[model samples]
Target: MAKAFASQGDLEEKKTSFTEIGRGLWAFTAEGDPNSGVIIGDDSVMVIEAQATPRLARKVIDEIRKVTDKPITHLVLTHYHAVRVLGASAYGAGQVIMSDKARAMVAERGKEDWESEFARFPRLFQGHESIPGLTWPTTTFSDRMTVYLGKRKVELMHLGRAHTAGDIVAWVPDEGVMFTGDIVEYRSACYCGDGHFADWGRTLDRIAAFAPQSIAPGRGDALVGPDMVAAAIESTRDFVDSTYRPVERVVARGGSLREAWEAVRAACDPKFADYAIYEHCLPFNVARAYDEAQGIDTPRIWTAQRDREMWDALQG
Candidate 1:
């Protein structure tokens, strides 16, 4: 059977420049679109956060080709989301790296997430059929690990749960630049289908501690300078807090999902209404928040059918 496109709205798939941050570090970002980072070491290249598909990732590869022909030695998946990791095969890297937790998510709920995300944002999956299947990491780590591309050192750390249980960030200490997958978004909505609200806030705090001069967030424009980076983190924290707190408050007052959704909308709509993907993310955000507020630790699976059912129930 042919798969259906996910989003009903229009999206532009524009090409963007690869901005150089340090001696060998670059950020590839489309205007308000998913962001990917590149680190060129003495010997090889490491790409952080592959795009939605091989066709889309080729655009990034094209940019990388401009600088060097160094083999893409590593493709680091910051998390297990289909939009992020499915492009791994396109890189043809010898090692696909990820957190053990992230690999587990792929093993556990990858198929459901693939279906759910494809249904929600079709444009992101531009060449969906080209995807080999769910991306599985060849190398997995628990806490932290360091990889050297000749002399440059890239540190991968699994911070506390935020966007997902196994969310990881790539820190280039020498460059003072960080690649935070979906843990921090500039002007984009933080998708919370599998997020931990409370832990998410704390995770932001941990990211802030790095004091990155520049940040290439999971989506949206890259943040430059300390002020912009701080603002991005705070804005992301505010979005998560604004979405989760109101829902939690309503749940405390014995509110139904509809009531909780209303409360969340009332609190978040005014401030975050203009953010990218806010409309698409709100229903799932509220559902996850509601479940957490009711003491559900792990998030439930979101199938395409369940996505629409929840959206209709809460968004109505």
Candidate 2:
């Protein structure tokens, strides 16, 4: 193959930032790596999006300790991607929550995703051996579910799909803050290998309708104000559109996957070339976009071997 995934060579440690987006609500962002959110309530705390492994999760737990010693009683996952869910055991949260559709994906393709991601990016899976196994939710909800950490109410809702079929966001009504898991990224690139391109914009629109004062995105820095929140949502929308539109056009003309890839790069590179994981996500994003444009409703499961074959095809 002419190229391996950009993630394969990403060994540099990202600077992790723990910022307060709202009172008692914090965002743990590692540059452009996966981000997690914290909500400290009257008695306990709730964490959103565990890191890739127990060792990485310890970093978030350490940050939480600095702010409050309250037990993390709930761990709410926004989706079922391996990088977001595998570190779950480290939280020790009695309640692990995910959308019912996400839980089903876990049973169906979770193991394959874990293997594929591990093969693609070893840096995120810092302590792969320590991961207990595929992380399963102790509790699952269909559309929306509310969990209260004492008096604090955190609403987890499936506001349509963008990054994945079961993608959801956590909203804090009092703070007017939302933790959008991969649905809205800041300056970082959206990993759309398992995304729903046609529905992404509508999902983003639903997030904007709430007019969140702040947002803890799936990646990139925490958005602290309404302006930043709005900007991120639109930029993410643009990224999704820019990626899919070119591929859609190519597919309509009966172009090959390689041609679609070239089309996507021509459209997206000038805008997103420098974004985090941009190169790593490009091929997979292009492939999925091609499939979606060709009428594939569900994303095919990605295994380690499939990742290699897909990469090789794109290279040729």
Candidate 3:
């Protein structure tokens, strides 16, 4: 197990908790771990995101078994991050779904992301050998797709670029519940290596317009009720704003990366001190935020080597 960015050490087994959102909707959350949502339709099941590995995903599958015997027919990749997509094969899903842009990212940088994430958090990659390589979506959409889980309607929309160029969300309209990928983490730190800070804010606004009664964020516990949902969105927005804006100002003043990092630390450390993965994410966040602030529209690719070099130079 690798150490968590905050004072807490690496997590072993995630404490799984199943929360019923709607009639057939369930959220599988583990203390601050990546979340996976379940939708049991008329005859089959749809899993929102795959975890880090098959071994880990099996735990989620086990939980699903306790509820229903429906075979998983669809596995949705909210984005192309390795941690969220690698365990996809375990589901044996008849169809793997994602945005077209997400598939493109997998083609471009999937291997690098896999290596980088493995190096960053080995604990999450339990039974790494069981992985059948990178996951690719079998079906993809450009903008939106509507899937019917029996009578329930599940709307998948590419709600603009936020966490990644291919980020999307799954909204259950009749239930007024949304599963926001990494775009809106509840209490967990936002990983911004491939994020677009400004666009993310806009994406949040779009999500807000929906007025979701329940929200299953990328990490942390599921937010129940309207007030908690609103707070979660605001918290995520504040995290992005506080982390990026000051770093941008420093970079614009010709400050060194080290100086800019220090500036961000001083500003964010106090407010987001207890947030999960803050230290692990800050360096990458600052780099991306700085680049975006400098008018870089697209995020640069992140490799394992680059990750370490940047960490040592700026964070060490």
Candidate 4:
């Protein structure tokens, strides 16, 4: 029998947790769902990574109301992914920010991605009708941009490419905490369908160089200390390396995608089998890694049709 496409089989809702990684900085994480970061500035708050729909985004807003009543003034998107950006309208922030490259990607393939993701994981889009349309950033920066919420300074920097070509991290200099989008995940599978596998490790190195005391990672639990921070970074690197190396070896031998799938599962399953979204991410990760190993510099856009075609091919 053919496997379910992506996360279509995943219908059970995950328990949500709101963790304080630093003073006034919170991480809103679901079991293995996409995570969002909250940075409570002196006068207002800034949210990173919107949920898939406005209804899910409102859950984060509800969590925010518990700690402080400050208005959400900024919504900073780390990259252009359907799950992360489609909920922008709910925030009603004065500014919605993304990297210049990310904005370009939205213009290029955002609609197709939205359609693909909605089909793959219907559970995330519980309130699909509430989503107005594709999320666009009102402001964009090339390399780095800094915004001050009164005395607090939050720096948004486009670190090297990893999860996607335009991935960025929000660094709170005063608190020594960083909100790394998908560039770093804590025990959660990295979704690499649109990733740059070759550049991912270097990006991890750049993140480690900062030695952040705390981190609100893209998924899983929030890292609250140097020990946990370092471990999560290294583990993420290991996950990326483990996934790509076996596929690269298979590609070098002129093995087919089916062979690469087997190779990746053999290498990754023993260790990452229990991780969040491991099964959902494996097929996409293998496809991208196989392409990258064969000298494909850019990941191909995945429409709903392409997603099913790829899944069907791999099932064989």
The local lDDT score (0 to 100) that residue 158 gets in candidate 2 is 98
RMSD of each: 2.9, 1.0, 2.2, 0.9
Task: Give candidate 3's total backbone clashes.
Answer: 0
Question: Would you list the clashing residue pairs of candidate 3?
Answer: none
Task: Go through the candidates in order and give the clash count of each.
Answer: 1, 0, 0, 0
Q: Lowest-lDDT window of 10 residues in candidate 2?
A: 1-10
Q: Over all chains combined, what TM-score does candidate 4 have?
A: 0.98
lDDT of 4 by residue, 1-316 (tens): 7777788889998999999988999999998899999999989999999999999999999999999999999999999999999988999999999999999999999999999999988999988999999899999999999999999999999988999999999999999999999999989999999999899999999999998999999999989999999999989999999999999999999999999999999999999999988988888899999999999998899999988888887753
- TM-score quality measure for candidate 3: 0.96
Whole-model lDDT for model 2 versus the true structure?
0.93
Q: lDDT for every model?
A: 0.88, 0.93, 0.89, 0.93
The whole-model C-alpha lDDT of candidate 4 against the native structure comes to: 0.93
Model 2 misplaced regions, further than 4 Å: none
Determine which window of 10 residues in candidate 4 has minimal summed lDDT.
Answer: 307-316
Model 1: pairs clashing at backbone N, Cα or C within 3 Å: 6-119
